[model samples]
Target: MHLIKSNWKIALGVIPALLIYCIFSIIPIFISFYYSFMSWNGFSAMQYVGLANFKAILNDSVFWLSVRNNLIVVAASVFGQIPIALVLALLLNQKIKGAKFFRTIAFLPVVISTVVISLTWRLIFNVEQGLLNNLLDNLGLSALAQNWLGNPDYAMYAIAVVIIWQFVGLYFIIFLSALQTVPRDILEAADLDGATEWQKTRYVTLPSIWGVIIIAVILCISGSLKTFDLIYVMTGGGPANSTEVMATYMYTETFQGLRYGYGSAISVLIFVFSIVMIILANVLLKKRGNRKPV
Candidate 1:
């Protein structure tokens, strides 16, 4: 009774947010799941398709190719972005000169519009007059320059690079915050025990922020799965759809191809995949955390 009386205002505050979440997030997901079983262009009468879309998607080569591309993006994000972010976070967490300035510079890319970043990189990846090719020529390595975004073999990699560059800053900020929260006494004790900086980092710093790392891992996985805008603006899943990921492919199917039902199916799959990955990550992390000696 006392708790309710004291925290009633706080509980009231969440109602508005809960209402907004249900209206915008929860309702839309249910609608999409419902629509996944129906065939309906925006202007046409709906027809019940009843798993036909899922069956078709199973047989579709392009769909699987897009899934493969999404997996690549996920791998790049989990492996490439997380490690780079950790390094940047660790470096910036030091008591160095101009730390704030460097942190700001590192985080600047995350706040920029996706379209802007895509267009900026688009010029950089251009074959003939692009920054990359020009730099190669200036370095006398002209033979090394190739069409980064045009060739099917290289297009997905180019997109993955852009994706990693744009989002690493966000993860860096998360890691930096976690790093700052590590208790100073523990670090001092490690130093007194004659631990090197690398040893302290691996043993003390990382273990202290393991939960944050797991959360960041889950965020990276989910974000990589939903990648769309930059790839859309840069490649439009083009050069023969080599750069296709789930969200862009979903957009193409629904808005461009007008296969609303099939697109809904794809969206559902994306949601399912994201949930599964997050759950697996959480379970694995929790298990590992439990096994670790206090």
Candidate 2:
């Protein structure tokens, strides 16, 4: 009777979630792969078309541009946001005056909706009367002022800046929490041993927070890959798909163009890319963990 009850409880907890996962994720993925081999309008019959979609994607100039733009975002997120956030985290962990207030203010942006951020930044970046340009003009730096969003060259960078601004705080918080767990004695010992600030950070602080760094890297990768709202609301992949990332491209392909089959193919592509990134991240993380002192 006890065994039967335990089995029933397990089934009850697991079955519903499994069923939901199948319906939402697993089944939809298989369907996308199936459809990628075909072409179909939403209301019409799908025509089987072999590797044509994949081949076409290989030659699609816009797709390549989108890929390049995404890579740029990924690079900027890693280089611009992560390291800076870690530095901020270290500062906040020092029991400085107003530390909690600064932490709260930093993280407030993350809680705000992306659409709102996009809209706000759009206005801020407005060419003529926008706050950013106006401030530059006021400071006698009008030569630096330009139409940030309208210019194809600067649009992608502008969006990336906004994304970094919003999300950096969360990583800062993660690093701060991880920093608190480092033993105080270790730091004090390093101070006593006449270790320089740079040396102590290099050996003690970094090694202690390595795991949190791994987690932050993974999060930044995923978040960058899936970036859509800022690109969408701010640029709409625009001026010419210059700032297009996979999420926005997939969305435009699927809904804006009403090419369900092509959209599904892009969806599958995104899934494959995300999986590869996750695997690569895990491999690097494991290597780091192995090298760190236990």
lDDT of 2 by residue, 54-132 (tens): 8877787887788888888888888888998999988888868998899999899999998999999999999998999
Clashing residue pairs, candidate 2?
none
- Candidate 1's displacement at residue 251, Å, is 0.9
Best by lDDT: 1
Instruction: Give the clash count for each candidate.
Output: 0, 0
C-alpha lDDT of residue 25 in model 1: 92
Model 2 stretches astray by more than 4 angstroms:
1-22, 284-294
